[model samples]
Target chain A: MSLSESTSRRRKKRANGVEFTAKEFKRQWILIAIAAVYVIYGIIFYYLPLAGWIMAFQNYKYKTGITGSKFVGLAKFQFLFSDAKFLQVIRNTFCMGALNLIFSTVMAIVFAILLNEIKNIWGKKIVQTISYLPHFLSWIVVCGLVHDALSSTGIINELLVKFGIIDSPFQFFASKPWFWPLVVLTNLWKETGWNAIIYLAAITSIDPALYESASIDGAGRFQKMWYVTLPSIRPTIMILLLMNIGNVLNAGFELQYILGNGVIQSVSRTIDIYVLDWAINGRNMDFSLGTAAGIFKTLVALILIVAGNTIAKKTGDERLF
Target chain B: MSINTMKPKKKKMATEDLIFTIFNTTIMVLFTIVTLYPILNTLAISFNEGSDAVRGGIHLLPRVFSLKSYKTVIKTEGIITGAKITVLRTVIGTLSSLIANALLSFILSRKRFLFKSGLSLFWIITMYANGGLIPTMVLFRSLNLIGTFWVYVIPGMVSAFNVMVMRTYMAGIPDSLEESAQLEGAGYMTVFLKIISPLCKPVYATIALFVAVYHWNSWFDAMLYNRTNTKYTTLQYELQKLLASVTAQGQGGGGGAASQTDATVATVIPITIRSAATILTMAPIIALYPFLQRYFVTGLTIGGVKE
Candidate 1:
């Protein structure tokens, strides 16, 4: 009789799928609720503010809220597309990104392979420590160091003249062609050591037997490296390559911001800097275009990430899913 | 096979290894000179008397060393205020980020968290699609966080890669530990904090270092949000402005120690003061790295191991 009566009063799953009788469901919901607050932390601070993308379509003003800002639809993009300066910014961004990717990866991989070959552990540790220090430096210090070395009377120029490489001191930063290489090399110097950290991990994971077999087959160090080491770390290389492709649009902001000058601004301006200049300095207060540029960067980055991941998947079993 | 792993070779003289060591040392010495010289030059300049910095040909050492530039730079009330803000922001920001990352990653690590896939998709979508900076700035202003230090820390608290790293590390942590804790009547929070968190100590340290350093180094947020409010400028921003002002003044051929206040009066500036300001700005991080380097590699690997 009690069971029959209870059957009439039985709990059912809620429409939102919280089973009334299930403690696991209740606990899950409770945890989800607590986590929802943090999800908002990501949303309110990191994600939702992206709604500011609408401003790219509007003529934004400090006086007007985003809702009140005048919508200009495609005008900002049209202007940007037509602007020669913006075009230059695009070219510079891509060129720098491509060069940086090539040089940083190659050098880092080579450095990692070389470091892995070090028979003495202490020497390797010292080299790693020395290399990683530069990455900790803020660009402000880097820029100053850069300025010191590149100045007309700086050590670089002095050395160049003394070595009979040049007749007189050449202004490194002042020259356009030199600026790009300088930026690239400066980045390489700061990042190669730190960047090689992952490759070192990949190399360490390589089975010792493979190297032994290569030696048994009479392979020298170079042959063992090419046949054994590189293949073992191939997946790491692929994944890192794919991940970096997503960052191609980011190019860099700090280096350009610091090294940029009137003479070299044309080739040095990145999309981030361009958007920044317009958003902060220009009178148009036309935030929509700036927002559009941001959106463009995000979109391009996303496409590259997905595309790279797909290509990686097709080529190798591993990809950033 | 065990001996085969060693190629069963004779102990050949390591002459080549010695040569390679010398080569490596030479490479590293050049690297050290390249890396440390400019930084050291800046340090020397920061220490140099403000008067001699403008002649500007300093290399490994300062020709006329003095601590006047440091005194002048450090004496400014703004630097103290900025440093306070930066340290506060770094600490609080790191705490918030660690919390957020841990929570997000924990949820994602659990297979039974029904919305794990949905939430990852949601977060990843946000990574690819965003309104952009101005809109975000507008939102900050509307929220009245524009001039607040929150502007510096909030937007960057939880990054995609950091979250992913945290998730991967959490996933790799043996799940049986959690099951055992549960069997002993430990709740999820207890399991997470008392047990799992400790297991991820190396990663915790690395993330702390990373987020802390990031907050310490960032000037963009301050540049954007506190541009006019020098009262809330971060140390890095203040340092940058000092450099910019010096460079602008140095344009004049007038030989001299330039006064910071009279930034416009002189076209020429001391090289040492600029270098000194740079050194002053970066000293904290330089000092911090050596102590943390022992943990760095292990921490870096845990946090950065690619999926």
Candidate 2:
């Protein structure tokens, strides 16, 4: 059946340009028809809501709706900047984000390098599989484990007290100082193995010949790793770092939300939580304020990504965009 | 002295290599232990007597084994309902999203498709920018998706990230196969269903695992869009509530003070119940983890790295 149709198509192609164009148009239109479903879905779900950004500039009330709400240019943004709570939230977000980014990157790189040094294939595979298990777990589950480990009666406190490091179990979660480190440590524990896979792949893809030459030059294992392995994967490292820099604002919502209590809320709240508090929380529902904060986050994220890509392009040819 | 045949130098290096190997192996063992300890500890605690577990000596094994926590968790009305909803969402959400994304990606991957770049650009922008929380909620409300089951499956059906991943994978398939199928008079849908999809199994497994795991693990949506709707609550959300209440109790009683009395703790869902529920929630992902590990690395590298 297809052979006959193809033959007819060929004959038509030879017979007239107009007919061929018309048939071709029909073929392409089917593709367009399929594309239309998602495109329309995208407009409704993704793009159409962008119209709600207008709420940011208005004293948006549920009764008045977006159109009828009184327009108050720059007021919401000004309030957000002036509010000490918002400023603290911003600081918390940046600190936690930077901490996670720095430690996770460094730890993953180090882990990957050390993992590559393992000569036993089965051992390497087993360790890697175990390491990635946490990444697949939900933040709630992870936090459950963390809380179990850090609870006054939990293992960490037990060990600490047992070893005479402390006379009593320490409150790891209750204190203000431990929050940032805890966030960073949790992120590292969850992400290091998963993130290391990319670096490991880069290491595997590095020309074995480079290592051979380095060995010939009397470079020891550490020396070869330093000179050959690190340099070879520099591009991968830079690309990942740039991508992460773009996502810095994400400094994690689920982890914080799951683990945070009233005591730790000051340290744990991120911009996302700020948005949720104002927009969704019943008592604090300020649509305009939430929209303004959300808009600020979105703008900063876009700027960071674009800037990171531009920097990547300038430093090397590894631009994400 | 060309070192390829230098016995003395090789012997000297062998000692250093052995030391390095031992060191590396030790670190890996420690890392593995650190990673696995908490999970195993949780399992142990879950199985141990709920009252005894609060005393906190359980490590790798249960000192006093009991199925009481699991029995309690299984008996909970919310958890059972949440499990049903979770399973339904995972099955339906994964299938629908996979089909929708695969179709859209197939169109985008075609070389001669007229809207390829335009549609590609449209989807890509959605990846970078979104209308934030309030607006998205407002949109969903206006569309009457709020408090509906469809909110879980529909809003996420056509994610740009998934589309991009699938598109990149499809674009790499040799065009000759698709062209031959076309010459056989296979329509676009037929070509996608028969030719492209069968060949795209690895990517499909990768994506299926991705989407399925996401649906299973997602609770925020349940909390956000369906907060008031008890009918659509998910397992994770229920677990979240349990966790919150447990933590609150822990804080209020100053961590184990309440657990000092078995009678007082029996009324509240203790840590053991939380652990049992957690294990139940994560059991499916753990069961399918081997499949995930097998496909994700290759799949992610293909879809993510090249771009």
Candidate 3:
């Protein structure tokens, strides 16, 4: 149905209700109409821009809109595959995603495990506060902070110099070898605390009696922790891991966008950044290529989510569904 | 205030607990240091004299600290206008969002509500599906909302996640409260407004903060459609321009347009100026975080567990 027809139907629905009058429908509809507006907004803004997807099918012209543009059809897609940068971005997205997932989960689990071992309430709370703080920082801020620290004359280089680790300051940002690792490590540092929170909550929920029973059986501290705490939070870990698998394509847009200067340009350009640069950043909006990129992202995200959900269903665990 | 101090008698600590305490203290201190470093560095750079920051002189602390960057920011044209616009958007956006979320969530929370499953599934589908940006832009243009204030506020006024959270919280509320209110001949609106909304103070506050923060932090809508429309640019978007454009200018790609636009002396405090803008943008959000952190662990923890 068109937007107006839907509004009329909404008016009908309002009229039939007990307290609803035709006038209240306008007010309630103005309020309840937000849903319709949301749907309409999604249709108008999100979906309709997709019609420009044809730009991918054509040698798009800025003077003429998508309709007036020449029809090329699958040529852009073919050109994309032929482009060597496509392979690098795909590889970069996956490799970075994998590292981020592995590092974040492992660090979170470790932090949660160690936190569980802590008896001092105030101390544990402090750790929680401090660790979670980075999660709140915008990538803009985080990148600025990183620039300050990792620049040649920054604290890290100074410390390295004072300790005589290097003859001269090195440009870490320029080093290809350090690019991916730095991205992963900084991500781990920012996310581990926030990510660990869910696990910590899960860890706390695990029955204490299990640990007490293990202790009664003469289980040592290590043995009890291994046999109890780790096992208890396993399901939570799996769920998050599975969820991460679905989000593997989202190797972060902001961080890559900011940190990716000309030095690490080849390795750092993920799919999202590619879309922003080619589609949004440049002089002419390449709606077709941009839509194609968005479609690829959407399709990959959908497939991964369904695949993960299916796996989750088979395992008989909690799923986003 | 001293009531607990004088009455406390069991001050003894367990031996195992003592070791654990030390271990935990060390962990907390280490993590705290990690968390504080970046923020402290940013703040320090923001406060540092412009030239010192450009030369990479500041570290964990400022060197010959100065308020020049902030002075430039405050004196810049349209800053108060930007701040006023941001504050207004946050308030109106939160109000409309809260209303829509509360109404929808309340309806969906009831099993007896008409078309509950279907309507909810519609929202759930929205999480996964989109028609792309071109169509959306066309639709908004057709609707005449492109250059209007409604463009920002209407499109994103309600979030599915907030709706789900509020619904979960509403489900937890006893039906007896509503039943008794109905017995007093109150309508659904009255019952909801009088009883449920008040009872949901914590949840409301949490969601309000979430929506408010989202509005305050968002520069995307403005970036997408507001570049030419000087009146519609939010504070975050304007600050983003101040931050990003300066860098673009310094790279000689844009010829120092941004720093020159400020009408202040073109000082070479590039990093310091960027840091200053960052701090100003994040200040209110960071301040609000600690206050509402209780909700993250308490009321909002409902859907986190599977079983």
Candidate 4:
């Protein structure tokens, strides 16, 4: 039979309340085949890894493999709690993550509001374009730029010295006290513009009639922005904040890894970096211990996401799930 | 308009709005300067004479201009190999990922596809719950993907986020278009390739640019899997290695015996070369930005607000 004849026959069968005909299966076979590929890919790459998390409980060794490794139960978890450095790493991760979330979110919102208020389209476009360019550059490049700018004799110090703000050049990267602030500032500089794009989009979707009504009520520019614009985009803000809460432990490994030095090691080593150090670069290469840390981070993130989603759902805001 | 004309009250509002505009413009200008200055400063240092750059007064322009740093960086063997590998992977990776993601998204977007929900759920679950770093690395190692170029191309062949965005975009396309093509007895592949694919150029370009940028900028995978294999090292990874060396040398109290060979070049700063390398690493992405700007912005707004 021709393809159309078979399709028509299948349609007739379907109309007659019959199901699972060979012709029906043949018609949808292409889609099924495509989906099968994705399903296999997901199983191998995604689901297999979840199973591999079993290594966290075992004394995993490359020679013996995960299945052959002796089961050590909660020994690795015990080690994590006993290790002071690991505890410090966790603290560093949370502190840096919280600071990053607060500063980046606030700056993005403020930048979006300011950009929205600009009447000159060309100026707004130019500023927005320039601001977001840094986002395209990798952390390696951003760290390189930050390093150069904060170097002892770099432009920052030159200006400070010339203005007599400081008597001499200060080593910004070397100081432990300056590490967290620098991380926060770098996060702000790299992400504020890109993050603001969502807020800007949200602002554009706000009803223009609301602004007009506010104008008729003798509302000034700031007053209209405060009453009409901010409230309108509050849902977007809440949703983004909730999502960011899930990532609070993922303070990131790259920027800290690149910019960190022995001087600021205490402040710079995040949980991901801690995992890399133990799993890949440790003296004995403790795979099981590293896997336990990895499992911990993932579980916390999952819990946070679930909690955030539940809260958002309850409050009738936006839920990621 | 009549009320404003009768009261002549528009002047106060105009003045207040003007002040607001002035404040906004000033803040934006300052921000632009801050963002642009670092890049321009690095550019200036790259061009300046190494000795002059070390003396530290170069701001916006080169003091004693020379291409020595650029020449040195271009001549490095690792950089050349790294660039070749980076470009090769980016082209291969972007093309494969775009095709894979496009196919998956197209399948999902079709209303006739029976298991769309099941397939989407399979991918979306991975987005929220991952095996994390160690297990994923172990899986890659076990597959023998650690030392091969395919490692980069294969693992990222299909991203759930890109699939979601493309699927949403494809769903927005009217079903009548696909039905018309199907009425002419076109198969699914023909309907997708000849009809729907052409119509999705904007979203395709958007996702393609994103995938390309990701492949270009990726270094973490190289640092992990390709650590032992220098042949597969990417440009970004090479730059990172160079950065580590520079930092190490700085901490070790400058070039120990290396500066003795060229006494005249002793004053030449290592940072000048590093800055030039940094510029070389970023130059391609910066160059591609202007052309890809419109598509990316459209993609962001669509993916951001709609999703």
Clashing residue pairs in candidate 2 (N, C-alpha, C atoms within 3 angstroms): none
Q: How good is the docking of model 4, by CAPRI class?
A: acceptable
Query: Chain A TM-score for model 1, please?
Result: 0.90
| Cα distance off (Å), candidate 2, residue A103 | 1.1
Q: lDDT of each structure?
A: 0.73, 0.83, 0.69, 0.83
Fnat per candidate, as a fraction, reads 0.44, 0.51, 0.24, 0.53
Model 4 lDDT tens row, B1-307: 7885746567877887788878888999888888888899999999988877888888899989999999999998878988999999999999999999999999988866656556777787777788988899999989999999999999879888898889879978998998898899998999889998999999999999998888889898987888778899899987877776644345333321111111122232377898899999999988988777778889986654466
Question: Which of 1 and 4 is ahead in DockQ?
Answer: 4
lDDT of 4 at B265: 26
Better of 1 and 2 by lDDT: 2
Query: Cα miss at A200, model 1 (Å)?
Result: 1.3
- Residue pairs with backbone overlap in model 4: none
Residues A1-321, candidate 1, lDDT per residue (tens digit)?
A: 112222222321122253334676676775577567767776786666676677778787768777788888888888888989878888888889989998999989988998887777887887888788888778766776787777776778888998999998887765678878988898888889999999998999899999888878878767888999998998888878877888887867888876665555667778988777667764545567778888878888888888987787788656766
DockQ of 3: 0.21
Candidate 4 lDDT at B238 equals 76
Residue B158 lDDT in model 2?
87
Identify the CAPRI category of the predicted complex in candidate 2: acceptable
